[model samples]
Target: MKIAIIGTRGIPNYYGGFEQFAEFFSVYLVEKGHEVYVYNSHNHAYQEKTFHGVRIIHQNDPEHKLGTFGQFIYDFNCIRDSRKRNFDIILQLGYTSNSIWFFLLPKKPISITNMDGLEWKRSKYSAPVRQFLKFAERLAAISSDYLVADSLGIQKSLKKRYGKDSTYIAYGAHPFDNPDISVLDKYELQPENYNMIMARFEPENNLDMVLEGVVKSGDETPILVIGKHETKYGAYLKGKFGQYKHIRFTGGIYNLAELDSLRYYSTLYFHGHSVGGTNPSLLEAMSSQALICAHNNDFNRGILGDNAYYFSNPAEVATLLLTTKKSDNLQLVKNNFEAIKRDFNWEKINGEYLQLFEDCMARHQSGK
Candidate 1:
């Protein structure tokens, strides 16, 4: 089957969840003997060439760095090009406001979109932008042939907000094999000495709350926060927390080996995201067999089940940090690892995606 993935910043995934999803799915589909193409942004510095046997279509746009406007332009150009490609299916990872272009495509490809976390509820967006996002999400749901939600919580949100029934297909995490031991020396963190938090330094991620909680708790365990230090929030976090001897802010380690090493060695994983549906980082940390103490939310609970710890207020988190025993948490961590292996592995997820694609194509052909 010929497939095209759209609505992301492009490959090599230097950014967030959807980009990484696209990268892994594209490569996996290619490996499975399917022809796959991805839309790459001109600003990404990616060559117009095949990567891992998957074709990359470079959409050149100079204004592609201008936030929402750039995304609009990129999506419009990608849709224009997609019409000419005659793809069997087009998978959009997010709701692009310019998605009206999909309606103009010649093939009228079976469109499948992953309705990522509730963008409208994010604290960073202005009132107008949030209102616009709500409308765009409705349009995408009504227009697309299939809508996918990464978690049941997101599916519920879609139904409540837009009156749309979405398919629940969660994101997958790749398993890490042997990690390099030398990378541990960089953080001066032994295998189980420090608590780790890996996520974007955004307002929704609640990094400040976590930091303040740690400071208030005064748990002797050191904390290491890893993420891209590009945003204003990230900069502020560095400015405020940089001097602390117990807290180490390692700005964005991109190498997979280094990331995996951190994940595998960390004693505990701190997840403070109050929004979003089944965060990729949380799932990955669980897969790595780290004891996960996630934000108290239905999404996190659904994924971790009863095998993980949850905390709402800083006091609860602080209490957990001080009271939980490594020996007692070991079984829960092992259970989470077992669950991930059984349910969230990339191989299983890729097969599920292919089946969904085929079903969408069949339904489209049958005039359903």
Candidate 2:
């Protein structure tokens, strides 16, 4: 089947979870005898070129710096070009609020969108933007032939908000083989020496809570926070905690191997995201076999099952840090790994998407 992926900052996954999801699924779909094309941001120099048997179509506003506006331009250009292509299905990863072009597309081409997380609930957005996002989400839910929810929590949200039935396909994680010990020494990290938190410095991620909790805990163990220092919140975090000897802020380690090594050897993985559904970092941590401690939420519980430790208050987090034994959590990590392999492996998850696309196409053909 010929398939096209729209509404993501094109692949190889340098950015967010959607990009990574597109990257993994595109490659898998191509290998499975499906022709795939990704909409590349025009700002990227390589946007005009094809990579790994997938065609790359460039969007007018490629910088992706324009936030929601950029995605609008991307979807417009994609829809315009899509009219000329003989694609069986068009998969959109996010809500396209600015582009009315999607509504113009030929209804015969099956439209499947993964609604990602609840973007409107994010604390970083302004009141107006949040309201706009809520409206956009409703439109996207109603317009699409098929909708995908990344977690059960998100599926529930969709049902409650729009009364739309959504397919629940969890995000998949790639397991890291035995990481190189030399890589650990390079970061001055001995196994179990530090707690690790890898996420964007956004308000919804609850980074401040993690930092304050760690400081209050007074545990001698260092906390290594790794993510991009590009945002205003990121700069604020660095300024606030850079002076502390126990808090090591490595701003965005781009090297995949190095990041995997850090995750594999970490004593405990800290996930404080209070919003969003099935965060990719948390899944990656579980895949790395790190003993997980996450912000207590239905979303995290749904993903981690009984294999994770959760905390609601900063005081509770501090208590866990001081009390939980590193060695005792090995079984928990092992159990998480087992569950991830069984349920969240890309090989299995991607096939579900492929089947959904096929079903959507079949339904369209049958005039259903």
Candidate 3:
């Protein structure tokens, strides 16, 4: 099958989850004898025409000059060019930027979209923007031939709100049992010596709440907050939390190996994401065998099952930090890694996507 993947910054993934998925899934699809093409941002560093047997097409992205609006232009150009490619399927990773142009999309290829998270509910966006995101979600749901929800929580919401039936598929991770502990030398950290948090500095992600909770705990255990700190909110957090001597902030590190190793060696991993279905970083943390401390929500509970400790606010977070120690999470860590291997493995996830694509294509042709 000839497949064109859209709606991400593209592969080699210096960005977030969608790009990471594109990187892994596109390569795997090519290896399985499918012709896969990934649309990359024109400014992305990897300029080659092909990467790992998968075709790469650079689409213009003026995000630097135009900000969020540039993403719309990039998607427009990508869809326009893709219409002429004669691809069997169009797999769109997200719809926030492109759903408005759904009418302009080609009618020939089967369109399957991955409906990611509740964008409208995120606190980062203003009220009007949130309404626009809600509309976009509806447009994408109506426009696409099929919907892929990354978590059962998302799947259920799609059914209740949009009255759309979606296939429940999850993001996957590969575990590294024994990564090099020497990677911690540069950060002045040691294996199982620190607790950590990995996430973007967004309001909805609840970084402030977690950090405050940690400070209140009064446990002098080293807490490493790993993520980019350039945003306004990020600066606020650094200013707010920097007074605590044991709280260290490392601006985002994109190297998965390094990040995963950090998580693996952490005394505890805190996941504060309040929105989204099946977060990539959370799974990576689980895969790395970190004893999980997660926000109490359907999405996190769905992923961690019964193996994680949940927190809703700073108070809960502080209570957990003061009460629980690394030794208490040994069994929980083992259970989480097992969950990743058994259910969220990339082999199973990619296979499920392949079958779903084939089914969508068949149904599109048959008018089912």
Candidate 4:
């Protein structure tokens, strides 16, 4: 199958969730003998035309100048190019900045879109922006050949709201059994001595709430917050909590090895994301055996199940920290790790994606 992947900054994924999905998914499909093309921005660090067996198509992305608006132009170009290439299928990773150009997508190729999180529900966007996102969701439901929801929660939401039946396929994570502990020393960290919180600086992530909770927990153990701290929220968090002696803001560590090491070594991992379906970082934390203290929400609960400790307010967070035993945390960590290995395996996810593409193609051919 000749597949063209769209809606991400593209492969070798130095960015976030969808790009990471494109990187692994495209490579796996290529290995299975499917000709895969991933769309990349011209400003991407990796300028190579191909990575692994997957082909990369670069386009002019004016994101630097135009900000989020530039994404529309990028998607327009990608869809325009796809119309010419005659791909068997086009996999759009998300609909945030690209759904407006759905008319440009070729009619011949079956288009499968991953309906990511409930974008309109995010707190970061203004009321008007949220309305736009809601409209974009409607457009995506109408335009795409099929829809994929990463979590069962998202699937149910789609069914309830749009009356659309979306395919349920969660994101994948590589289970790390043996991480380089020496990397921990570089950060002045040790196994089970510190806690970690890694997520983009956003209100939807409950970053402020979680950070305050950590501070209120009053533990002498350091809490390492990892992410880009240049945003307005980031600055707010620093101003609010920077006085805390135990809180260390380790600004945006992108090294995969370092991330895995931190998760593996940390005594507890706080996943504060209250928005989104299946989060890639949360999955990675599970894979790394981090005893999770996730925000109490359907999305986190769907993935973590009984294997994690949940909290809503600072008081709950404080209580959980004060009461939870090390032995219990260890047991939960082991269970969560196994769950990740069993359910969120990359190999299993890639195979499901291939089958989805094949099924869509087959249905398209049969005019069904």
Summarize candidate 4's per-residue lDDT along 1-368 as a digit string, tens digits: 99999999977988888988889899999889989899999899999999998999999899989999999998888888898888999999889888988988898888899999999999999999999999999899888889999999999998898899999999999999888889878878767788888999999888788777777878768889899999999999999999987889989998887799888888778899998899999999999888899999999999999999998988887776677654566888889889888899999998898999888888888889
Q: What is the C-alpha lDDT of each candidate?
A: 0.81, 0.83, 0.90, 0.89
Q: Which residue pairs in candidate 2 have backbone atoms (N, alpha carbon, C) closer than 3 angstroms, thus clashing?
A: 42-62, 43-62
Error of 3 at 367 (Å): 3.3
In model 3, what is the error at residue 173, expressed in angstroms? 0.7
Question: How well is each residue in 244-297 modelled by candidate 3, as lDDT tens digits?
Answer: 878888888887788888887888789999999999999999898888899999
Candidate topping lDDT? 3
The order of the candidates by lDDT, greatest first, is: 3, 4, 2, 1
Error at 18, model 1, angstroms: 2.0
State candidate 3's TM-score. 0.97
The residue-by-residue lDDT of candidate 1 on 280-323, one tens digit each, is: 88878877777888888888898988987888777877787787
How many pairs of residues collide in model 3?
Answer: 1
* Weakest lDDT window of 10 consecutive positions for candidate 2: 96-105
Which ten residues in a row are the worst by lDDT in model 4?
320-329
Off by over 4 Å in 4: none
Which scores higher on TM-score, 2 or 3?
3
Q: What is candidate 1's CA lDDT for residue 186? A: 83
For every model shown, what is its TM-score relative to the native structure?
0.93, 0.95, 0.97, 0.97
